[model samples]
Target: MKTKAVRMYGLDDLRLETFDLPEMKEDEILVKVISDSICMSTYKAVKQGKNHKRVPQDVDTNPIIVGHEMAGVIVKVGKKYEGQFLPGQKFSLQPALNYKGSPFSPGYSYPYFGGNATYNIIPPEVMELGCLLVYDGDSYFGASLGEPMSCIIGGYHANYHTVTGKYEHIMGTKAGGDLIIMGGAGPMGLGAVDYALAIDNRPKRVVVADISDDRLKRAARFITPERAKAAGVELIYVNTAAYDDPIAHLMSLTGDKGYDDVFVYAPVKVLVEEGDKLLAKDGCMNFFAGPTDHQFNAPINLYHVHYSNTHIMGSTGGNTDDLKEALYMAANHLINPSVMLTHIGGIDATIDAIMDLPNIPGGKKLIYNHIDMPLTAIEDFGKLGENDPLFKALHERVEKHNGLWNAEAEAYLLKYFDAEA
Candidate 1:
């Protein structure tokens, strides 16, 4: 079989090529990738290449596929897993394979098993570790988003608060407590906001603080304060850049009581320090962003850690259970993962889209593995509609959903741009 995929050759090098795939073993399953959400981690991998822990040192000769957040349909099930999986079944997977204590994952490690491809072979380790998931969602993008959403879910679950006298700590963010997300207007930050509101034990108030007014405004439009109120939670969007003393201004929102939970979405030192100051007694701060610098350091009040029960922690990726929960929530409409998406393109566009992800200035960039379109923002659909009828229709579909991407738009895109058509 032949597959089209973006391969990493070296640092700052990626090439989109079609190559023949070897015969699949009975223990391996072949799948047709439909949609994959480009991630910043992929950008990091490309920048570091073999130097990255997850990327192989022999990538120049044995280049690996460069996507992980993927969703698609099974094309061929191996004989060993005949009864468990079937052809044409929708699928997604937990990419954090933690297989045999190795840091290798699907997107960064495997050559023929990554997401940015028309077809991929599912390794036996994925099946054996129970990381392969059967997606029951209507949209492929939603399944592709499951991996990121799971990371958000894991952050929430990983937060812990301690009791005054007990040795065991309480897991999860404090229920009905004040919460704030610093630099929260970005894609994953928005996902955190969505999950914060949708969860059973909701926070009393959620404040999303960011420097960009445009990003904050867009986030508010998608996850509105009205929607938060209806969900029995208070939601506020603040442009922290506007205030001279941002920390003092944000702290004032909690009535000077401080926030029970603080999530720092950016890797900036100031953001981390500010989040540390805003923590209430027993407050748990989650450093959600991964910094590129290995020597990244920030100063926190150790006095508060000793006397005020303040603590800090971070999570890189979610476990299998988190991915399943994310998929279930999306399927049930408990949360809308589309809130993280802002752009769409084809397999041909992936190389450039990923190479220039930082400068793109939007949310998740979705790549349909079998199409040929350039990377186009959902907001630009209306303008592109002026010249192209496809964009005209896509613009109309998304306009119906408050200028957001949805399944209707996805189905239309697949039909008109079907690679096999």
Candidate 2:
């Protein structure tokens, strides 16, 4: 079948083109792509192209579609997996397949398997590896947000504590401990916040630190103190830049004992250093941001790592189990990952939106399949609602829950932004 997609040809070269997809094998499934959230990883892939570890060396000859955080409906099912899945069933994929210990993944490696297209082919490995998931939720945007949420979950799970005598470390963050989330107002940071708050043994106090007062204020709108209190968590928002001594100010908030856990969400070196400085004895510092340059290095507190029992670590894309947990939590309304979405638009807006993703200055950017609307921020719905009837209706759905995005809003978007409308 012919489809339109943003194909990455080479380094810094991405083109939107119409092409015929290769016929699927008897074991493959065809999916009509619905919603895809632009991830920073996609931008990295587009800029690196063939040089990217998972991308094919002959990427020019085999231009791959370039998105991973996506969801859709199964339009065609193969005989091999017919009984397990059926047409019209909504689904989202765990893009980090890690098949047979291979670093290669769908959007980064597979030519016809990425999410930035109108259609995608689910290879047998995805089904065999149990990466294809049936999404029963109302919002495909929430479903697509699952991948990013899992990544934060994976990092949270990876946090460890050293076993004093055994020379080994215990995994998972300490229950009811002080935690710090640096750059806590960004999309990924907000996701980390949601996951941090909803988990079964939630943090006692979570200090969300950022440089931007505006971003911090906006974040508070969703992760309110009341909401955090309801979750049995004490939410603290702090503008790190407001202090004459930022590290000292953060320590003061934790009563100078420093934080038990610190997760740095930015690739900035200063943030990494600051995160280490705030580590308490036996603290765990998780560098959640993925840097662009392969050789990038941040100065870590080796002294604290050994003496104070403070350990530092980082987690990449989540594992299969993490994806499952994220989906389960989202489907059950246990965590509101929709707080991470600040913008929504049509699939046609994907190319430009993705190219400028680094500068978009918002949370996740969601796209409805086959729509042609420009990128619209959820925050802008109110102002736009004052004039346009379409935005006015959208404002109602988006504003209903204190400016949070929801399935009803997404459903309205899909219906209103379709070709006929």
Candidate 3:
């Protein structure tokens, strides 16, 4: 089958290319992708070219399809797997193709098809691993968001306490704990916010700290005071330049106790610095965002790890359990994922999207498989459906009643003019 994908040819260059998909094996399932989302990993891998783990430096496989976050309906299930996953079932593909002797995983060496194209072939091993999650939604682009969200879930499940030798320290987001999401308005940071809010039990407060006033305001639009209050959680938006005294502001927010959990999502070097200052006693600081080469270093804070019982850890990739949980959370309306998506386009737009990462509106970028359909993000900036009275009424209600975040809020959020600011 001929399918289109955004293929990375060389350093900092991506182009839409058509490729012939291999014949489906007995254990494999062929799926027609409905939607996909551009992730930070994709941006970093495409931009840095040789720096990332997934992007092979040698480029032995030239023009590699560079996407993993995607969703689709099963089009053709292998005859051997007829009863397992039937055709037309809505599902999202999990992209952690590990080959290092993990149980039931198709190793990385094999050509594992991702979700960027119109179709993807899922190997029998992946199906057996039970990583694919099925859910009902209008577009698969939103479903693709699950892959990243699942990775966040897995990151939280990691034993960060063990890494820092804080044997007595218990890690992960806990009820009544303070969470400071540094760089909290960016896409991954916003994801961390969604995950932080979906803690089953609410955290004491979820603080989104960033240097840009626009981003903090953007964070406010999604996580409104009423929304947070309804969820039994407090949402605080703070502005703190990387060089300025952000720690003092964070300290003030926590009454000088500092935060219990901090998610480092971007500009990780700054995160390392603020981490030493803002982490509460026995706090867990997670490097959720992967840093670029030469852009990261282990903080020399042995005392904080030993005396203060600070825990440090990092994570990448989605697991089966995390995918399942993410799907459930998205379907049940626990996350309001639509709030995190900011850009929507097609395969050509995806190429442009990856290139525009540095300037991308600080939210998720979605690529629809059916490029012809109009981009319909559940955001406030775009005009509501003309004939759909329900959508129009909802838009008005959000703007008027839910004054916390609406069209005006979206405009405020999207304005990020001052880079030096």
lDDT (tens digit, per residue) of candidate 3 on 1-421: 8777666666787767777888888888988776677776677776666554566555445456677777778889888788878888888766675534442221111243665676778877677656666777544445778887887788677634333454454545766878888877876677777777678745888898888988777777766767777777888887777536677778888889987777777756867778667888777877777666665685647798788877776777668778888888876767656566665455657777777777755577777655532333445432653676534654554456333223332222223211010
Write down the lDDT that model 2 would get. 0.86
Candidate 1, residue 403: CA error in Å? 1.1
Best by lDDT: 1
lDDT score at residue 186, model 2, on the 0-100 scale: 90
User: By descending TM-score, how would the candidates be arranged?
Assistant: 1, 2, 3
- Model 2 is weakest, by summed lDDT over 10 consecutive residues, at 412-421
TM-score, per-candidate, Cα-based: 0.98, 0.95, 0.81
lDDT of each residue in 1-421, candidate 1, tens digit only: 9999999998999999999988999999999999999999999889888999999889999999999999999999999999999998989999998899999999899999999999999999999999999999888999999999999999999999998998989999999999999999999999999999999889999999999989999999999999999999999999988989988888898999999999999999999999999999999999989998889999999999999999999977888999999999998889999999999999989999988999998899999999999999999999999999999999999999998899899999999976431
Clashing pairs in 2: none
Count clashes in each candidate, considering only residues at least 3 apart in sequence or on different chains.
0, 0, 1
Question: What does the lDDT read for residue 323 in candidate 2?
Answer: 87
Model 2 scores a TM of 0.95
Better of 2 and 3 by TM-score: 2
lDDT of 2 at 275: 91
For 1-421, candidate 2 gives per-residue lDDT tens digits of: 9877878888888877788888988899999888888888888888777888999898898888888988988989989998899898888889887789998887788888888888888899999999999988767877898999999999999998777679787688878899999988998888888888888867899999998988998999888889899889989999988889999988988899998889989888899989989999999999888887668787887887778988888988788789889988999998888889899888678888988998988789987756778899888998999999999998998778789889887778777866321
Against the reference, the lDDT scores of all candidates come to 0.93, 0.86, 0.67
